[model samples]
Target: MLIKGYDDGPLVAGEPLMTRPGFWSNHLMGMCDDGAGHPVPEWFGDDGADADALSEVLFDPGHWPVFRVPAAEGPGVVVVYRNQPGDYGIDYLLTPPGRSSTEQLTDWEGDLAENGLTWHELVRIADTPVHEAEGAADPAARLLLVLPLLNDLDLPAAAPARLGAALAAAGSPQDTVTHTAESLLAHLMGRSRHDADWASPLSGGY
Candidate 1:
């Protein structure tokens, strides 16, 4: 299940399609600060970890890199960006070809049901403008959001190379942080297989 959106605002209403320029432009300049010039978070480091991660996506991009937490429905990656200035909000993306069905793609409540899970979760709900331009007639289609709290999710031990360290250095974990990629993946897959909607409230995970 792939979940993607921008921090400045919700994704374009309709197809959820975003152009490469729209995606990469803000990333190239690093995070915006409106005009306050806020310091980068300690986890991001002086070298700008967020920008560096975006670079990785641009160059050796694959299925997108799934970080820690919430496990994964299949195989994919999570991409983040700071689209707006002075906004504490962060954009998160769960790439595709992973989950068994699209229904789970945007489900947030379903992710919290994992046993022993910590980290906070917030879903941004962007309403469709009065004059609709991007999305469909359905009210659900106009809502644009991302799980910014994922930054605190735990990382798997053998996760790819320095991915664990990167996540830690970025300060994404909120608790003891000891879940593995394999287990997370299995959990997501399992939830998808069963009737886990009982765990979530929203009709669509979006």
Candidate 2:
């Protein structure tokens, strides 16, 4: 929804976006030909960005610097950083994409806390030296570090043991059978019988 101007349509997220308008306002940015501009903030280094996917790219200098990534079902909104303050690791906020009213997901947003990491912090923590990475104690940070090992990470003979050790440290060690990813994420956030219907089937909901 990074429209070229106010005439494009409505907002990608919503109104009153941008806490630090300093960057989003004055910069000519976007993933297009920059609307045929000479230079835009989307420009990176000498060559350019790896615009591998257009739908995933955000930032538009002509309008709001962000575009909405829609939810899979129902009417949904992603509360982006531009729409609010603080540097939480949260890329955005959204409900479970169910029948719940938007208010139920967005209500009392002021009551939410701001003490979370940013993308930069997450990358740093994930890349930090094993001994020095204090954020390793944090489940989110630890998860970030170990997740790649669980996926396509190419490891040789000793890597199995290393991966095992890393998984154990992340509290996601191999189970007698395979551990269901859905269960891990859902259980991390805890469960409520009332929320059974909203639960992930992979996690068995309730």
Candidate 3:
């Protein structure tokens, strides 16, 4: 959740929750093998970084940073690398909000065939690591990239694609849609069959 930290409440698509920040103990380092004898900037850590510090690294072209995207339930958190790690275009880590349990999503490698994603297309997307941009962690853009996979999983696009055209028309190509926190929450509650029942539709009904 960026500098504000996790809300422990709930998260929905297009809600603009901040991605997980890189850590000194938990942050990502530069992946380039500069072969420099001295320590590269990528070797450093910024685990408990503040907003201004994170902003600096996020916009720096030299770093191959990792960004987080919260699952609609918030119980699961998805972490992705902005740049390709060699032939693979992206790297991912899945865990709970606090990262209690972790799973890496490297299926895009041999698992691509099973998941139905084209290696060529993935490689193309990887070529331009979103982290290098100012809005590297834009919730809207992230949704577009991962939307196709939502149905197979237990998640939702809090903002939904209904606003895709409008977001694009507004000139933010990275943002697939725009949504308010309440809208996202409502979207999740209305559409997520798995999670919708967490609370009764009419708990207050007589």
Candidate 4:
């Protein structure tokens, strides 16, 4: 269910119209003129113009676009926004149960504690080693580090082992890591049940 901006209103709860095993979360943000001369908020100061534009396009209701992604476990909010000068941005905000009325770091911290580690420890384990690389690092390599850490901490695994294998085969260790992190997040934040409802998309297919 979707709740629009700046209002305190009741949410009509029901099963989602469609249920997939996993999906992407997209959020939109950016700076634009809005016909005014002043610049909108700068996400990266000067390097965020494209991001801003993307946000505007995604959030413009006239287009009435609904993002479709793989299904996830817990409840989440999809955020889309437009900035000054007509820029846009998009991303998914996972809203786990009992975390908070508003999505915030405190909610994240609470989940971290619910697992075996403090927030600091979680962050430390998730941190990537500093290195200069030509392109983005492979996600699977990062997953190798993350999955083990989450396992060691007794955190619930979000993505199954199959997803990891897919990342490994695709040559993106970081994607594997990202998939693992998402799974961990889903598990900690209470989305695992939802994940279980769908046939494992990454199952043997991965």
Candidate 5:
């Protein structure tokens, strides 16, 4: 599952907010500020800043690379792609200035069409209630539950379940449960995937 949005303003009613340029930039970058006056990174390939020059590289119908950078001033861009044989595809997200959060999310969804990438929006789990089960007491079990949920939310399958387990195992065992929850949250937000070295926080086991 993949989840992407920008940190701008709140989506307004009756106004199409997804067309903003900042939303495009933030959506491509995968991370945006929470509308709290934070910085956004620049486009990866706009000026040959280490991004491939081929527009086809973004929609080749295969597995591709993901890119991310620290929260900085100016513009920010992030992209995630799959590198399957004979098929390469990429997703673009960016954080432009003066937009709402919902607008940013909507733009990320819209960019799929603009960039010719195939994808589906994740279903909202706000109705899924957290129950008190034995697994809730075991971090590993909790992590497992959360992982699948994030997967349901469109996070990549390569997310680190083992890391969630380890984080669950390290502390008071109960603390692991929280870690698992956090892991699920991170995954939903495209933060911790094993194959996502370019953007995965788990790249260094953190």
Candidate 6:
């Protein structure tokens, strides 16, 4: 099936995209750090061979291209994903469609499940690369699939040319990173102050 996309203009061919600097390591680290100790993604492996196959997928965009796909219910985005070596298993994180901002899903577990979304085994495709590796699906950062589409769910070879376009588009992934970083930092800072007050003698517990 032909995959539909947002931009109707001719697509210019391009190579795989690399994740922006300071995202995976510094930015992601800062965001995921909380007293609860959430585990961040493994950005890299040992310096030699025998690296984890999906170790760098999300951190290194070249291995994991962010794209849009039809959700079971409506339009959704398949941002960062990792499939096994045989491509047998696919695990991904998506922002539920029809939301104004990803902030609506901040309560991830309760929110996603309430929306009937799961992080694993969503797509049922025969050939893994044919569907996903075809090209950048939502490079223009538009909601709908722009490339030609025979049907909605089954997207085919799309325009890789549009990949870099989202960087300049409003509400792009970069924007998500920026907003999330701000919120996370604020949360951590507030928590630190709260804890400090509890420990302080002036708190009047004594």
Error of 6 at 201 (Å): 51
For residues 1-206, write the lDDT of model 6, one tens digit per residue.
Answer: 11123122222222233233322232223333344655333321112121223234333433433343433343343333222243322222333345422211111211111122211112211112223433333333222121111112222232111222322332235423433333333333333122221221111211
- Candidate 4 Cα errors over 4 Å, as ranges: 1-50, 67-176, 183-188, 191-206
TM-score of predicted structure 5: 0.18
Clashes of each: 12, 2, 9, 42, 45, 8
Residues 91-191, model 2: lDDT tens digits: 32322334332221221122223222222222333343334311123333233322211211122344334333433443332551022232222222221
Could you tell me the lDDT of residue 110 within candidate 5? 22
Report the lDDT tens digits of candidate 3 across residue range 58-84. Answer: 434344444444443332224343333
Which candidate has the highest lDDT of all? 3
Clashing pairs in model 3, backbone N/Cα/C closer than 3 A: 13-158, 22-27, 23-26, 23-27, 23-47, 24-45, 24-46, 24-47, 140-176
TM-score of 3: 0.31
Arrange candidates, best TM-score first.
3, 1, 4, 6, 2, 5
TM-score for each predicted model, relative to the true structure:
0.24, 0.21, 0.31, 0.23, 0.18, 0.22
Q: What shift in Å separates residue 27 of candidate 2 from its native position after superposition?
A: 16
Runs with alpha carbons beyond 4 Å of true place in candidate 6: 1-15, 19-31, 36-116, 122-127, 135-206
lDDT score for residue 56 of model 3: 58
Q: Comparing 1 and 2 by TM-score, which wins?
A: 1
Kindly report which residue stretches of model 3 are placed more than 4 angstroms away from their true locations once superposed: 1-62, 82-85, 98-101, 106-139, 151-206
Over all chains combined, what TM-score does candidate 2 have?
A: 0.21
How much does candidate 6 score in TM-score?
A: 0.22
